[model samples]
Target: MTDTSDQLPVPQRIPSGIAGLDRILHGGFLKGGSYLIMGPPGAGKTILGNQLCFNNVAAGGRAIYLTLLAETNSRMLANIQNFSYFTLTPIADTLSYLSGYSVLEQEGLEGLTALLRSEVRSHRATLLVIDGIVTAEQAAPTVQEWKKFLYDLNVAAEILGCATFLLMQFEEGPASQPEQTMADGLIELKVRSVNMRSIRELQVRKFRGSAFLEGGHNFAITQEGIVVHPRAEAVLAVSPAELPKPLATTEQPMRMGVGITHLDEMLRGGLPSSSTTLLLGASGTGKTLLGCHFLTQGIMQGQKALYFGFNETPAQLMRKMTRFNLDASRFVAAGQLELLWQPPVQDLLDVLAERLLNAIQRLRVKCLFIDGIGGFQRTMASTERLDLFLTALFTALRTLDITTVCSVELPDLFSPTVTLPQTISGTTAMVENILLLRYVELHSQLYRLISIMKMRESGYDPAIREFRITDHGIEVASTFASAEAILTGIARFSTVTPGVPPAFETSARPLQEQQS
Candidate 1:
């Protein structure tokens, strides 16, 4: 016989016609093979199938689109032309569409098979598409009929040696039929919600005889068709390069002055640059005012700073700061300070990351302040809310070599038996410094007490200091000594016995004699 092996036609590789998608597929679908596309309703199943048919014809291979639910060829063409791809006249002319079977009628599957066979032979078709097999299933009178029709159709397409694509609508639960088992390849489209926003994902569930990407990737549909953004984990196999060496001057630790001279002295100069500082206090305890002082001082030192306000608008914030004698309008007008007032309502991680990146680029900021962390609690899951947000925020701020200050409202300031939730208090230990602000009773009057609870990599004064908000901003008053419970937000004094000597003399005497 003539050399039969040499007579076999070479297989063709048809392009998916989607620029980004084609890159992921390593070219496109293979000729003389079958594939299945599974997704829920409104997942753009029909549109993707139509693009495949049109693209094949444009590349010099004939295509036949067999639709069970869609309308006639003219209607399909008119609808798809709205997309820019209508200019491909060659594909438009060579493409053939067939759809007239009623799924409700028992003749739907039979009619499709007859039409498919005829079109395959007449056009010598290299590619075939079944717009939807689910439509046929819905039309069948009984489950038995549906199973038979699906099995027969699968065999017919395989025997014809035409590269076929079957579009199926998947239900919410598991796949009931063996359709997925029979197909050579299966692509699944899924939708998921992140922070109340829907995200589209595509996963290659199965692809026989080919090394395919296994995980899901993000994608979007636009007027030009479907576009897929490959997951970072999929393409970036090598680790990133180590960070660049810091400038000679930056290698020496810098001080982030606390905006007030007395506070800086209490902190032993100031907070370290590139460090995270936690300011803990109750509501209306001047936490925001302290943060504003930090930002204003940073701007004055020629370093750009950012202030994120969760509770006030930019205009309102500026007006409020003016009352504290810190004019913020000058720094804003000078492009040295940026005020981001809105609390992110979307994926807090994504929104915060994006905004921080933008601020670093636009303002060249060196310091950042989050007015309060409570606003972000609702945006993330409870278990990971605190740690995840803190880690991400810390990492981003560190990348810019920026000092970050975060203020948090404490539930209880002095209850010895009360313990804060792990999510709320755990992040405090992660910072380089912790500043505690409390309302203390001194001389039978309530005064603000400021103390440095923790200071890493530096020494700080641990004694509580009295402070007040004055016309010139926050000013520290002289410290006082008392033998009463004054730091617990209340002041009470006990009467000294007549026989009790001075505190110094009582220590020198015996315990029995002092008690007597």
Candidate 2:
């Protein structure tokens, strides 16, 4: 065996060519360090290895991808060509593939080692990737021979100044004998199905020379290739330019008409532009109706809008809204409104974010509404995952300066109110405004109430307004006066002393009493 440490000193950091992944490694991979990538079938282990080599070659460095299990070079080239960095001649020159299946199947470790050594020198390879170590191991007649082969391969990689990558498929337990011990670094790719949706995660089990980002991180497989999300950097210092400037007290208020004049007046115009608003209420509280009105108004003003409905199908939602006299078909036919009715099994937040991005790009969407958050939460088994998804979604949407409205369901109005579940509190806390809708009882009758809970950038009436869902959609009646505990979804008449007469008293009782 050769002295591995004395072979070649580590080179400077090499770019992974993946933006987010590079950040996780604090820059990029160690230039000349050999690493092991272990995962199950279809974990994207080979694709990641190919991406590393492709990135290096694209940046003027030489790389070689040696395959052991498969010899489909043409298919590999075609698959990789989809990426923006892929080039035919340059890639062919800089990147070469030597298959071990041919040599190992024909002769053994002696022939395999001979072929690898020849390719290492002839190709002038700087980066060496072993497609499947299992194939090489299976070809070896004995365990001792397999160990010797890996040791020789490592020594060859060291002497040649090539950064090596060994691909291994691991089962439930740890990797078998010499393979795990011989590797300098280890990365495990895990794909788990959570709530019937597949989530890809990556864990750096070991890194010899440098520290790595601890724990697993979310990743996605896009048409471009595998993209990993980098760990969020902490903000320490901020310049004066980074600090938000105070808004002028006399700034003109921008409005988004809700397609109802009375509702607009109640909102002192309508919803604000470039802000996140939440419509909170229980079932039958006109939350969907309000969101529909917002989208319809945006369409009328020539600004496109997108509505993401998780609970109801598009047809069902349209039919229901028609009963309230909202003609959504006009906006739909005009291509100004995009309605996305997704099943609860789907990741609604991801779908919503994707559609929002597309709409903003194609239609210059000014308003985006996620009809109800409850349906989204029900699909996600864990609150932490839901929160993480929403945080990423909201951050992306907020950066586009798109007016966003998220409707949330209230199971019990009297329950201690929270903007969102504990898992997603970080997301809900960032919302700029909240519109609270509730059903109240007054004079033995149930009446609908609307109150602005919070508005960050604009002034809004604090008083609760009486509203009803009618044939013309939601219309605000007169503002309630001398009312206390209105937010509790209940109201009572103010007490009058013996000598004092009541300001207003109806001889007829309300609908609640009639129903009773």
Candidate 3:
């Protein structure tokens, strides 16, 4: 038999009271791990250090926040006193704050080590944070001395069974830093500027004795503290076919109607269940009202819905819905539909994704209408990652069995061809169905036309139809002439023979079920 006495079952973890943080850290920090948190000034290093101490002490465990040649303890506390996490009562018992500048100056490395050991052991600290640790590096006259001090701190922290965090200002090529090699993990925070906006992001460069999610993740410093928003692509990895069919309120079905009888007919009875659809249109082309129809139809089926819009406030959307007699207030009052309006402002892509997903889970929503999907492009970290980001988002929604309809803005109607941003051109495949809504110039009047561009999993009507937005909402034409019908259609794409005119088909095409 193997000698398993020294082999522990699993490493214990220290929970950091940060939202979405433990998930990225693979269940928080290893109990005896030593981590280096490095970032530039105003990058949230001091706040994170103090917040972690507060979190650890709140859980009945002791924590120590030590500083060497840095701001005094009272000043540090004053800075973070306004945060909600600050507790005045706990500081007397479970938490300890001290200055190590005197010991470091008097006895150098050995004296500093002795002070740390004595304080941590006396308080029985489970967590330790050293703020402004960069001072120690500069005080050391040689590289070897600095390396030894870091090595000693790591060894002592492990011996005391304390998870320690060493906070310092951002350094150039941090991977080459001495503490990086000695510490058990490295976390770097940055505020990156792109165009006129600045985004805060975090990356776990290294984590020992456990597996952590790699790559950069966005974070925000709020009143409570730092909140991490991991990339959706890394968190939601289920492929389309692999996702389970969703409808938490009812048994799985094949199709759901969009509330418009004619549009449903064009969609082969209704849109496919648990599928994503893109409603592409120019401004004032009735795309938003069409999306409202999708949401209302979902509520009629006993499914909850969400209308997430960027440009329009909830009041504006509610007014528009009322104008079309959608009973928007009743649905809202009954909790059948929710309107989440987030302006196109200082928001990160990952942050938006996390919030949307959380709302879906909270309300058990089955239908979602993302009014103006193009709004997401405004804050994407990079245009190239949009495809992956959208793919992951769609995958997560599908896995939850939610049916989503997203609207994209096209150029002005008078333009010969609508040109979309180059970034959005590649995301066409991310959605299951594609619908086109355009305004047609016919006989000095603008006629609204709707067409099914593509349906990956189902067959749909290929012919275009004229639709009108009445006070009662959308109404699609029922019939077309059979005399070379599709060839005329006001002559834009329809080819008219020199002597012949385009006639319409009067009969309806038989609709079929989606592919099983």
Candidate 4:
């Protein structure tokens, strides 16, 4: 008797049966509550609602999908048959698809509410989806009548403990309609033009009684229905305090070779394991070859590896690697290596990040080579979120203990000194190491030169060394100590001793010859 009647009921969550969607909702929608889904035509409102209904019904709860459009039931079935979720048993038995258009036109809003109440009771349905709520709004004589009808429907749904969905046709931004006020949650779908391509996004405008993921999450309508790709920054944001404590500083960090002895020596042993490295180079400067060497070295060390190629297909990359005598197909067949080829064709950055992370986790990838960061950037519509995206991505990699090397093509090869492009989203600071590969003209010959520009963890050799790609692998030649302008894309003898030939020219001989 202690004010029990005034107690608020516990909110129950109903899973949408969609992985990312449930996470966005912080679980799922509140059960026994009416929600509104607003979107423009062809914005996937109907598909989303239908997916939820079918998923609920499949989980042993009955559902009623009432469409206010005048389309025939057979046509609706045919239209939905293409989706992978559509099944004959659920459609014929567990779920009921009814038309509310005739009821609204003939009997008006009150009749529509009565029909919903009767159907909910008869079917013993826990889920109710009213598609094309715009028709009922139009059929009502006044705004007050529509509000009354919405209130009555909500009451009826609440009485039956049925989670309800009202799909409304919205062309633009959020509207201040009475139905929205009456609903417990509001979901909006949008289609926007990005770089001449349309991208579908979903947002939760309001969700009562629960904390939800805000902002827009990209989605797509595939044969499996709606799949949401939550932005990594929003989904995986973690505070530094949340990260696990590191080991004692006295314990030396592990390192891995880059498949070249001299390069490893310059790196003070080798690259620090689990560190992120940026390979800044121009085209034809052996960036891809360097990445191949990294992956092959990992494979040789019995570590799993992943090569995410943006500009080349798996077959193409493997064929290219054959020239270096690195046969990746064996490791690929052994399940120790994964070659993922994704071209920059209307790809979403969030989707790419999710896919890469998933692969890394599933494959237990210890070494990762992302060939062509520039190609990945081409897929993004805006660079504004790139910094946050990179932060989240690198944090995840470090947490997973994956050593990553991403190759970014320099815009101009003829520049005197290398500079991180202003267009790059401040990702340089996040990288633990920076290796600059450039084309330099020395003695009327274009040669590849590499220099360790920065190493965060420890000191590294700052010498500009000549490198050559051979049939076996990449080999580092003698340092360009005689060439003062090595990094200026133009080179000349720094100090000449008349009797001594150029050090690089003499040292550019075969490895065996130099050894001899």
TM-score of 4: 0.89
Q: Could you tell me which 10 consecutive residues in candidate 3 have the lowest summed lDDT? A: 507-516
TM-score per candidate, chains pooled: 0.59, 0.66, 0.89, 0.89
Query: Candidate 2: where is the Cα deviation over 4 Å?
Result: 1-35, 40-114, 120-128, 134-164, 170-186, 193-199, 203-246, 321-325, 346-352, 379-381, 388-392, 413-420, 425-428, 442-445, 481-516
Which residue pairs in model 3 clash with each other?
Answer: 246-401, 480-504, 480-505, 480-506, 481-504, 481-505, 485-503, 485-504, 488-502
- Estimate candidate 4's alpha-carbon lDDT, on a 0 to 1 scale: 0.81
TM-score winner between 1 and 2, please give it. 2
Candidate 2 structure quality by residue, lDDT tens digits, 223-263: 76888764221111234454344558888546777776655
Global fold similarity of model 2 (TM-score)? 0.66
Tell me how candidate 3 scores on lDDT.
Answer: 0.82
Instruction: For residues 1-516, write the lDDT of model 3, one tens digit per residue.
Output: 889997777888998978577889978998878999989989999999899999888877899999984578998888899898998999988998999998888888878888999998888999999988887887788999999888888888888899999998886864677888888999999998888677888999999999888898999888888878987778777755787744455543588799988789888889888899999888888889999999999999999999998888999999989988899999999999999988867788887887798899899999999998777877787878888888888878887889999999887775546576677787887788999887655434455567888897777888778665666677675643421232253323232233222232342211111000
Residue-level lDDT tens digits of model 1 in 101-123: 55335556676566677788787
Summing lDDT over every window of 10 consecutive residues in candidate 2, give the lowest-scoring window. Answer: 502-511
Task: Give the true-structure RMSD of model 1.
Answer: 11.3
Better of 1 and 2 by lDDT: 2
Order the candidates by lDDT, highest first. Answer: 3, 4, 2, 1
Candidate 1 ranges beyond 4 A from true positions: 1-168, 172-252, 343-349, 381-385, 413-421, 441-445, 477-485, 488-516
